[model samples]
Target: MKPNDLSTSSFIGWTCKLLAILIIVSLVVDCSSKKDVYYCPMHPHYTSDRPGNCPICNMDLVKKEDTSEHKDHSNASNSLQAAESISNEDHSSHLSETSSEKNSRELILSFEKQQSIGIKTELVSKRNLVKKISAYSSVAYDPELYSALSEYKEAVRSSEFLSPEIIRNLQLRLRQLGLSLDQIRIWTSGARDPSELILGGKSGRAHIYSQIYESDFTTVKVGLPIKFKTDVYPEKEFIGKIKSIDVILDKNNRTLRLRSEVSDPSQLLKPQMFGDTVIQVSLPNVLSVPTSAILDTGKQKIAYVQTAPDKFQAVSVQTGKNIEPWVEVLSGVQENQRVVTESTFLIDSEAKIRFGSDSHAH
Candidate 1:
């Protein structure tokens, strides 16, 4: 137990401890090097000394690439960073191309929409210039016959020679002779009742005479032709000539009559048949269009001028004398222009609705 001996023992113990630690480290290194013998490139942390699959990821561990000649860690890091930056640039370029394509598509759609709007606007502007007029008229009968009946009755009572009983007996005798009592009474009353005013009373039994427009006499030139179609035989057209035109107007009816003789002279063309009369004023040839082309709305007369397929513009026009399927256009129309004949109502309504909506938007 001397001090020097103690110091020497301490130094020996320290040497043994150092040698034991060195031996243990060498054994551990040898064992680790021989363990699994494998490595993974994707998971650089995996380093097995023996051939085997990576425990962290199910991949066959491959031998680590030899990089001992370029062992600088800083150089490896720089190469990886450069590759990552190039990949990012490529992705950015792809994104830019996609955005440009989308922008181009959007521009094309907008252009198409604008063109559609322009077309609609043009159509509306063209359709607003037409005028339309519509009117309604009814067939009327002569009123003077009724007025004359009243005057005739007053005259009969004023005569004082024939009593009411005598008038009744005369009416009864007329009825027995196949004449109506009303007819006799009307005649005795001095009323110019067209139905009661029979010709050749008791003399010409089969013949019946009727009065017509008296003022039309001037037009009743010899051999002048007249055509008429009675409602009784609507299908049959009767051709006639003016036999006589009375110069005197019927005071009650205020209308003159023309007596016409028909070629057939059939009983079908009887007096009191209601129908339309067409008088040819003997005018020269005139330009006209089909009456179907005109759309009448009382206030104005409108016609559709076809501009394109399913496209039309309403035009205001003045018209005169309508003949079946044809009418005389006085103004505001042109020749050879296509006009809407069918489906006019649909076209007119669509045009108006479109125009109204457009105006509201504006």
Candidate 2:
């Protein structure tokens, strides 16, 4: 053969070999791309290139469908099965926890769903739960009460002339005038004059009367410090300690009368002058959560605690005093745990739908 013919033959063979190698490489690449992918049944987002257990839920990963249409159908079926299994598992766990836990139900929400529902969380922590009681107050002035006291004192002095029934009626009149036995006893005993009790005496002090709700009757004690501000002295704060609390609650308005002797050296407070009173009662070093986080179902109190990202568990808690914006968590929750604050009702509705109505029943 000619030398040019031999070189042409060698080049043609090399070209054919290169084409065959390229075809084989293409086939291998295509086959690798077509290999089955595995994903966690419980956590579909967790996938593996090969068969293995899901790192997240520890469930075996199942083969994922390749086609879009088939994948959607398969995912729906798998989700239903996973939900059923999870419900069964949770039911067993809940039964076992009945002895220790008051009530429990686990719930999972996707990030997108959580964003759509505007869920918010807050950390459970130990803090001073300060309860602030606000009430309407006014400088005290009772002419009728003063007259009644004078009559009672006169009756006491003239007991020899007055009958027993008349003196007892006089004392009953003082009690009806909203004086406790202690106050009537003190004034009649001449410990302090009735005028000093009603009006500012030589001590330059004034009497202030505040009406607090029946709900705060236990919180407002005799010696609790109170602060008041009148429109006339908006910038200034008047201070006092509760001197007395009415033994009887006002039946009509459900309020208890609190009498506090305010330091009025300037005598800025006048009779019937209206102001706002605030009584702050501090509860120290208690485990607390946001008030919004608690769901009081009459019989039981439930709080949702975030155990993982987008996951929450319903916890039955014993609540103490409701310090607005926060509440005392006496049990069933720990400090530093995150609790669902906003959209808690929405999550609870979802939990009911998923875990059945009795999921949180005690």
Candidate 3:
């Protein structure tokens, strides 16, 4: 053989050997890829047939360590079956939770529907609301007060002939009849008689006889503003100050008798003039809503709160004193929220039908 022919044979042999090594490497890679199942550890539900990144978590797929080759075939089959059953159960539970959560947080009403239902809303306010307690009363002269004044005056006049002990006892008695030291001292020095005190004193004032219920007795105190309106004088509002509250309860009515002194400048509030009294009690700034916003189902007091422009949610609130058109909101709403004021009953009816949470029906 020539030298060129030998060199050609050597080149062909090296090429064949290189091709054989490449074929073995390709087979090994194919087998390894077939055994490997790639999955994202961050998203356990995601798996890929080939090694790739997870679509959801954007994390690199991790190769699951293969136990099928080392374990019994029957055991591998049983494990696969168990995993499938658990996965189905988990998927169903996840779907149920998603549906329930969606319903719980949302209640969508169209703007047109809201207008048709005559819905009206007002922003919850944190301001002073004068909690008013009401009671029907009659104006009358204070006889007991005048009688004590007379006895006190008589004791004072006879003090020159009477003992010092008698004078001290008389002073104590005047105090017991609800007279302050200033009142008795002023009465003694002044020229007003007992008859003038009974009918109409120099001030031409009268006392209002009222009953404060057990619930109101504790909250009411002297010096609170009082307003009285009689049927005869409809427009006139007689303002007064609470003078005294009886220590003993009225046995017949089971209420506390409260006496308020009203100066009758117009003399409209005369003796035996029947009137309704409203006591304005000042309270600290608290959360409040309109009285029309509340809907009581006997057991629960609910108010419709506007979570969105058209969507309203029914929330149970703890209520306190009522001041005419407004009421104290103790809880279940914030000061900045908007509450449905007018047509609240209609909103509540619809909400109950839609949400089906009328635990207290009838």
Candidate 4:
């Protein structure tokens, strides 16, 4: 073969090989550009070149179709419409829940039903509530008290021989027996016998002893008018003024001792005679509501207020002193507001039925 012909054959073979390699490279680049893109159905923004679960919602990733530009625009518009529809549906559901919750807080009663339930209301107002504290009483002839007073007197007389601590201890004993500091000072300073204070003195003034519960300690005062009626003299009423109240309460019975001086001119009153005593306590200018309006749930005090015509709402209240038929309102209802003074428990039951127990949790 000639040398030129051989060289031409080799050149032709190299050109064919180069054209094949160029075609193969173009095919690989086109296939890579057309690869499928995957995206999460629940979280559309999360996309990947391969199929897998979405990191956000753990939903399967779906393949995105490769379509014409116009088809892509159409799909985008459809997705937007679907998203808006879902948003509107969620907003409507929220509105429905809010309306349902609002309706649960109130209870309605018809006029006929109100009458049947004996429902009544009263205005919250400031008033002077008078409380009558009644307690058992007896004509004073305390032998233990007399002995303590006598020891104190004897100690004072022998002051030269008795240590100061001994005398002070005797005075403390008198105090423990229910004598106030002023009463002790008076008895110790005077030469008169202690019997004059316990029994009827020459002036026909007899001591009356009564006890009040610790619950009434705040309402009682030194000069409150007290009336005593004894079984011995059932027809007569003995009048007196509170002279002193014990500084300490009795630990066992939770009561405070009260001493009063009553006029017994007829000398009919005798020691240890059983009687009943009434003390008048006046609480002035305090905000209060009717006792029936308060429903004590043991854990909380609740009052029902008429918020609208035939509609009632439960409100929590803090209460103070209770003077029968009237109770002090520390908080919850405003003055002049109307509260259900009757059928409060029924209203509370209705509220619990309508709104569950949390309706009046405040």
Q: Please give the distance, in angstroms, between residue 144's alpha carbon in candidate 2 and its true position after superposition.
A: 3.8
lDDT of 4: 0.85
Which tens-of-lDDT digit does each residue in 1-362 have in candidate 3? 99999999999999999999999999988877756678999998888778989999789999886676656766888899999989999998998997665455345689898889898899888887667799878876667777777777888888899999988888887766555676567668764455544565236566787778877887799888898889998988888888767666667878887777777865555666788899988877867888898888888898878888867777789888777678888898898999889888887777667767752232
TM-score of each: 0.33, 0.60, 0.58, 0.75
lDDT (tens digit, per residue) of candidate 1 on 258-327: 4444544334433344554444434234456667777786677877676554445667778765545466
lDDT of 2 by residue, 168-236 (tens): 998888776667788788878887677754564436677888999888887778888999889999899
Number of clashes found in candidate 1: 28
* Model 1 TM-score (2 dp): 0.33
Best by the TM-score measure: 4
Weakest 10 consecutive residues of candidate 4 by summed lDDT: 196-205
Give residue 350's lDDT in candidate 3 (0 to 100): 77
Q: Write down the lDDT that model 1 would get.
A: 0.51
Candidates arranged by TM-score, highest first: 4, 2, 3, 1
TM-score quality measure for candidate 3: 0.58
lDDT of 4 by residue, 35-126 (tens): 77899988899999999999998899999977776598888999999999999999999998987766557678888888888899989999
Candidates' RMSD to native: 20.3, 23.9, 14.3, 7.9
